[model samples]
Target: MTGMFPATSMPDRDWWEALWPDPSGLLLSLGVEPSMTALDLCCGDGYFTAPLAKIVSGRVYALDLDPEMIVAAKAEVKHLGVSVLKWIVADAGDVAELIPEKIDFALIANTFHGVPDQPALVKAVARTLKPRGLFALVNWHQLPREHTTVLGQPRGPRAEMRMSPEAVAAVVEAAGFRLLRVVDLPPYHYGAVFEHKG
Candidate 1:
């Protein structure tokens, strides 16, 4: 868990999964179903990706900026006998190209904070998702000036890239998504669901 995060994650997936253990259930609460096809953006080690694969019971594509993490996730999925998932590496922009258009659901999770190009990311998300598709985003709440950090600096105060629910909502809305549900997940993270505008 210590090295897994590389100072770039909300929390490494293994550590976070151990704490919450119910992101899949949370996704279910947001209407994720076996009948749908889904994508996991920034899926680190297939933590939520595995569960999403189960939930969709259809097609699952897990995208990650870190190729090492994607390789590890693919290994885990193979060990788990989960074959419906496809692991791909590259930025969300590359994902936008590969998936083309109209996926039923897409999730960014805590990865939004790591993305350097906010507009390109939002536009890519908008382009790939179907109208009415679900997009779930999760991130940490804002903290005071002395308790937050970015890119490994205990630099005091949450960076803008470490988007809050409202901030992420703004981006999604601006990209043609509408807010749907805001959910409390494990301790330091939360989830927001949105629907692509029709």
Candidate 2:
């Protein structure tokens, strides 16, 4: 948790969503289908969870480590008219225990770089997924601290906390996930999709 963003400091949900790529379209591009069960790991404010619920026919688990974030996400999605999501307040590293059922897809957005033990987190995620389940991650592209902090630049974790795409892929591979593909998400981020080998 050295470089992680504090839950208390999170921006308004609408404001946060406006700052990044659309989660629904992004998930669709990553091969997320309407019939899949997905996990929105480290989900913050239901920004991605709401859209995921709309797209996935099966259940979507929106889990965050902070209890306040879980409450906020639940309130945020109440008006979506969709009841496909289950909110869980737990650490990202405890997915295996927190999520009892197998999942078809697991999504981690903008939070992987700050994970204290990337390999352990990936392993836990892998364990929660069914065989061949997809694990998609969106992270800040490695850049200089000054570059990310400039006025009008997209808000993200510090540059030192960012990890290169290759580094993230390597961790996923070491955790028993086969590399699928990496896609550029926009002016400031990249998405990597992997498949659970187990």
Candidate 3:
């Protein structure tokens, strides 16, 4: 079964912007290069997908389980006048079969901790990546939910559901990926970049 991550539903756009501030810069910091064939896995509302498309000149594939989210993402990218190479509405667990070509980078943000079969998901991602391909995860810091706030209110997944960088590395590395580095995204998030060892 496809497991929905806790708090996977996006916050209001205002709060999301307030938290991320600059989605494009965040992607760049995660080692997304212009020439890379990228996938925005679980691309809720295309907040990062549009910017990623702009960065890579529309050579990006975006997928989310929610068709409504995909529609919103299509509209978001349309509003921005940039295009994604493909928009897929399917479970994230089926990504290897969904994407048509090997990807240089894949990003799943704010949802990794809730995946029911993270190792399986990582292995599926490993199958879709090119050798030495990058997989980036953006997750909430493993802090008490009450301690991490946006707009003066607690936000993100429950405290017990959060995963530390080391924990993430252990799971991902076991599935044929090497942890590259952990980037502090500040105010309650961190970005972990991994390289697929094919």
Return the top candidate by TM-score.
3
Weakest lDDT window of 10 consecutive positions for candidate 3 = 1-10
What are the lDDT figures for the candidates, one per model? Answer: 0.71, 0.79, 0.91
lDDT per residue (tens digit) for residues 36-71 in model 1: 888888888777777778777738888877788888
Top model number, lDDT: 3
Pairs that collide in candidate 2 are none
Q: Give model 2's TM-score versus the native structure.
A: 0.89
- TM-score: which is higher, 1 or 3? 3
Ranked candidates (lDDT, high to low): 3, 2, 1
lDDT of 3: 0.91
Q: How far off is residue 10 in model 3, in Å?
A: 1.8
TM-score, structure 3 vs. true: 0.97
Clashing pairs in 3: none
